[model samples]
Structures are given as C-alpha cells and as structure tokens.
Target: MKLKLRVIFFLIFCLPGLAILGYSAKLAAAAHGLTSTGLTANGTIVDHERQTRRRVGQWYCPIVEFFHQGASYRFTDNDDCKQSRHDAPTGSRVEVVFDPAQPSRARVDSFRGLYGTSLLSAAIGLPWLLLGIALVVRVR
Candidate 1:
C-alpha cells in the first residue's frame, strides 16, 4: 500500500511539475538567447477578429532586421492571426519575436510571454492532480 501510494503521489506531482519546468526552460532559453536569430518582425495586420475572449488563430505579421550576436537578425511575423472578427489592415504592424535557435519557429511578441500560457496549463492540469491525490487517499 505504501509503495502504491508513493507511486501515485510521484505520478501526480512529478508529471505536472515536469511539464511546468519544461515550459519554463523553454521560455528561459528564449530569454537567454539560446536560439539562432533574435529578430523583430514588423507585421501588417492581414486580418483581425473580436469575438469572445477566446483565441481564434494567428496569421503573418511582418519582419524587421535587428543586430543580435555578431550578425544582423532578421525577424518575421509568421503567426496566424487568432480567429476573430476584428479586422486589421493589411499593413498593420504586428510585433513578432523569434526563437534564436530556430528562427523558423517564430511567433508574435505579444504571444511570447510565459505567464498566460502557464496559467492556462495549470488551470487545466491542477484539477487532475487533485483528483489523483483524492483517489490515492481514498484508496488507502
């Protein structure tokens, strides 16, 4: 019983914690310039939407050249606009941040932060964690 409980506990906590840790590591990597190109993109709002607070999708933004390491970094807005009704002009500027290691893996600057995405993951993950704990306790 003790071993079972221990395994259950580890599975419940470690898995979620690892997920959060991995996400944090990814963000830290971006912040520390572990990627290839640190480029900023000038985006034109090809489209827009404003329905509920839910995210729809992302489109292309724009690109700008900036100097990072010893070379000039070229950033591009490769995000597909969230599905919405708010219309953005074709030439609207959309801020884009890129992964230095993988320049191709780019996204809008506004969407790069870790807080909101972390929260969303936690909101969905915590419940399952709690349920696992509850089950373990009950079974014992």
Candidate 2:
C-alpha cells in the first residue's frame, strides 16, 4: 500500500514538474537565441486592441509595423495579459527585434515582450519542482 501511494505521488508531482521544467527551458533558450542574434529596427504601433476573456477579463494586444529590406511587415505583440493594451499606444514608435534571416519572425523589443513567457514559466515551474523534490525525499 505504501509503495503504491509513493508511486502515485511521484507520478502526480514529479512527472508534471519535469514537463514544466522542460517547457521553461525551451522558452528560455528561444528567447536567448533571438536576443543574441536578432536585428533591431524602429517600429510603429499601428493598432492597439483588447481581447475579452471570460476568466481573465480583458487582454491587450498591440500591432506594430516596421520596414525591413524595403518591405513592410506588421506583427501583433504576443502578450495577452491584462493591461498589455496600455503598454503601447497607437502611433507610438517602439523598437522591434527580428531574425535577420527571417524578418517575419520578430518581437517587440521590450522585456515583457521578449522574456515574459520564460519568466512566467520559471515562476510557476520552480515551486512545482521544489515540491516534487520534497515529495521524492519524503518517499525515500
């Protein structure tokens, strides 16, 4: 009975914690790669809008436009958190960081825009990981 419970606890906590760690690592690696090798350009906030969600209320997303190699590209900010709409007002100029080889793969050059996912993932995953470790120690 005790062995069964230990196995159940390990499965419930350790497996998910490992998965979260993997996800967070992937996010951090991607952000590092972009910030290290990407090119920067001045972009304009072309549009700002709010998306309504039942659980979280409203999230703000901004659309930005920039020119690269004589061509124009527009991309929406990936942040969907509340108050994100207020971060960039329309017509405001902002920095854009993009892959030189693929201009379409770009992001707003801000801490939140670039590292938010990785930060959030780490924040959530760290506690789960600690708890899983504690549980494993207790089982042993």
Candidate 3:
C-alpha cells in the first residue's frame, strides 16, 4: 500500500514536471530561432506597470514601443519568468528583436528577455523531476 501510494504521488508530481520541462524546452528553442533570424529595431520604454500577485510582491513590467515596417508596435514584458522586475526604467532605450513576417511577435534583444522564462521554468521543474524520481526509486 505504501509503495502504491508512493508510485501514485511520483506520477502526479513527475508528470507535471515533465510537461513543464517540455514546454520550457520549446520556448527556449523558439527564442533561439527568433534571435537568430529576427530583425533588430530601437525600442523605447514608455511606461511601467506594477503587477500584484497574491503571495508574491508586486512586479514591475515595462511597456516598450517600437517601429517596424513603418508601423508602431507596443509590447509589455509582463511574463513572470524574469528574476528581477525592475529590468528597465521608463524612457530608456532598448534593442528589440522582431520577426519580419510578424512584427507583433517580438522580444527585447537580451539573454534574459529572450530566454528567461524557459530558464526559470527549467530551474524549477528540474528539481521537482529529480524529487519524483527519488521517490519512485525509494518505493522500490
């Protein structure tokens, strides 16, 4: 009975961790591809917004505006993957990398901006995965 329970718990924890790892891998690959084949543009930090979370403190998300193909595009760096919320200040200039076919799909041209989410996800998921594996091995 204990072994069965351990197995069940292992599956419950391991499956989500594996899924997160897969998703993070996909995100990292897409970011790498975009960085390699995207066009560069100058972007301006227009504003900053504070995103509040239940348990976590407020996060500062930057609103950046840039031009592509003579049209203006605005992007918000609001994803929770960044280690720091205060990455950019208002009125600062940043380099943006955008897809030529779809300018709306863009990211700040930096290592953290491009792949921070995936790296963060991997960092979190890997430990869960290892714990799951250890639980399963102990069950045997």
Q: Rate the local accuracy (lDDT) of all candidates.
A: 0.51, 0.81, 0.83
Instruction: Point out where model 3 deviates above 4 Å.
Output: 80-87
> In candidate 1, which residue ranges exceed 4 Å CA deviation?
31-37, 47-83, 87-89, 99-103, 111-119, 122-140
Better of 2 and 3 by lDDT: 3
Best by lDDT: 3
Per-residue lDDT for 113 in model 1?
39
lDDT of 3 by residue, 10-48 (tens): 788788789989999999999999999999999998877
Query: Which pairs of residues have clashing backbones in candidate 2?
Result: 60-85
Residue 88 local lDDT, model 2: 59
91 Cα displacement, candidate 2 (Å): 0.8
Q: TM-score for every candidate vs. truth?
A: 0.47, 0.90, 0.85
Tens-digit lDDT track of model 1 for 3-110:
787687768765775566566556555544522355665544443333333364444333434333455544443333334324435445656556656655555556
Q: Model 1 lDDT vs. the true structure?
A: 0.51
Clashing residue pairs found in predicted model 3 = none
Return the TM-score for candidate 3, rounded to 2 decimals: 0.85
